[model samples]
Target chain A: SQKIEQNSEALNIQEGKTATLTCNYTNYSPAYLQWYRQDPGRGPVFLLLIRENEKEKRKERLKVTFDTTLKQSLFHITASQPADSATYLCALDVRYGQNFVFGPGTRLSVLP
Target chain B: EAGVTQFPSHSVIEKGQTVTLRCDPISGHDNLYWYRRVMGKEIKFLLHFVKESKQDESGMPNNRFLAERTGGTYSTLKVQPAELEDSGVYFCASSQDTGSTDGYTFGSGTRLTVV
Candidate 1:
């Protein structure tokens, strides 16, 4: 069986600091991984997607890095703000399948 | 463009009652998906709809749940004789079928509370 894991605990950081979150998986090889941001009482919003062959991807202040050998990915948000406080989820695509498996997610709080 | 939209933002039903949740995907998006998150658990995939056809329903919990996408536009998921375990938040997402790189746009979701 395949399993995805996030930090599980909440992370609190000061405003304007960089926040890093991790996602790790085991047993299955995925072609691509994605990150999403979800606020309380709302659905997730897509953030970034990185393929297995890619080492790093960035969009504005958001950055994602994928390491196939370690089966881990790291998501980073620079100069974080209070609005960035939310739960971040990581998802992996099941090979040859249209369904995606997601981790439990890590909650991030940026405080001034 | 408008993002995906779901009806009945919140619902409370008793066991053995039937509830139907609707989702309207973005315009021109050919791929739609259904996912749910139970209390204290990760979000899990329930099914996928490629137009009007069910491409993958491997994650559906049991026969009590049925999802339909008619005319390849809006989708409906019904839970028959809903149980207490069916309480959770259901989300709908859609993406353009321009290969695999495009990410999905998700709806606000419907929260189902079964008592």
Candidate 2:
């Protein structure tokens, strides 16, 4: 069976510190990977996307790295803030213009 | 520009009853999609639509669930004889074209409770 796994179910870190989340998958080769942020009682919002050929992608304080060899992607939030606290999800895009298979997601809490 | 909109923010109905959920994608967005997240599970894709046609619906759980996008405008999902396990959040999203570059905009979603 194909699977996409995040590093942890919940992660807690102090504000201003850097937070790192991991996504791993098995039995599938994805052309691209995307990350999304979902708040409680709301749908997910698109964040960052990285292609297999690209090693890393960055958007302000957020950064993402993809390693197809390992079938893993890492998401980092530098200078994390309390407002960044939410569930982060990683999804695999097998087809460029198609649907995504999302990971279970990791809840991040940036404590003040 | 207005974002994708889903109606009936929440609905609670008994099992075996029928329920219909509607989604209005952003204007000019021709690609519409349906996704769902069940209790304690990751969000899963249900179907995708391009204009008035069903582009892909392989993720649909069963035939009991029907999705239609007539005239390529808004879309609707109807669950006939809803089951207890159908209780979850249904989300609708749309994009101008394909790929992550054109990020998909998702609606707030509708919470369905099958009692």
lDDT (tens digit, per residue) of candidate 1 on B1-115: 8889999999999999999999999998989999999999999999999999999899899999999999999999999989999999999999876225767888999999999
Weakest ten-residue segment in model 1 chain B by summed lDDT: B95-104
Q: Provide C-alpha RMSD values for all models, in order.
A: 1.3, 0.8
- Mind giving the per-residue lDDT tens digits that candidate 2 earns over A4-32? 99999999999999999999999989988
Candidate 2, residue A2: lDDT: 97
What is candidate 2's CA lDDT for residue B88?
Answer: 98
lDDT of predicted model 2: 0.94
Q: Give TM-score values for chain A, per-prediction.
A: 0.95, 0.98
In model 1, which regions exceed 4 Å deviation? none
User: Which number leads on lDDT?
Assistant: 2
**Residue by residue across B1-115, what tens digits does model 2's lDDT show?**
9999999899999999999999999999989999999999999999999998998999899999999999999999999989999999999999999884757899999999999
